[model samples]
Target: GESVGLHLPTLSVQEGDNSIINCAYSNSASDYFIWYKQESGKGPQFIIDIRSNMDKRQGQRVTVLLNKTVKHLSLQIAATQPGDSAVYFCAETPGGGGNKLTFGTGTQLKVEL
Candidate 1:
């Protein structure tokens, strides 16, 4: 299925501050979740991932949290910088569904000085 384009929501954060981006997924049956960062003129870059079996996962200066009860997901960026400014997207896939992902509408992260 083709994804429909929509105006992305914007999030503004101060440089050197922490930034929290949130997503609400529709599929309760999804077992895998991934967060992506997309810069202008580039494809989405994998930032982090979490499984439904886990509540949280951490990466370099980033963390992904999943709440299965509410079908909610969040990404936290520690000490956000100008380099961290981008459009963030959350994607999910059902268990054993090889390489198929359903993406949520993206949010633009703006790092303010």
Candidate 2:
């Protein structure tokens, strides 16, 4: 019951600024994790991921922090840009599945000039 959706379709931001999108996931039994970014109406692109065994994982310009104790997760974007505007989603694959994912709440991001 942790699934959430964006209230607004757009989030206007400057050309250069930090952006943080929020997501809520269900199923505490989920173990694997994944973060994806969708530009416009396109399919989501893989950003970063971490497993329940670890608390955090870092990517080129992204960092994912997970708190298994609270079943919470967050993504940190270092910088903001026009191309960075998109919807971000955090997903999980429960322990019983083989590379299957259950998506979580998604937050839309809009960058303004």
Best by TM-score: 1
69: Cα error in model 2, Å: 1.4
TM-score of each prediction: 0.90, 0.81
Residue 48's lDDT within candidate 1 is: 93
Runs in model 1 deviating more than 4 A are 1-8
lDDT of 1 by residue, 1-113 (tens): 42312234899999999998888876677888899999999999999999899999999999998888977888999999999999999888876668898888898999999
**Across residues 12-97, which tens digit of lDDT does each residue of candidate 2 receive?**
66766766555555568878888899887699999999998998898877888887776777777767777788888878888876
State residue 69's C-alpha deviation in candidate 1, in Å.
0.6
Model 1 has a clash total of 0
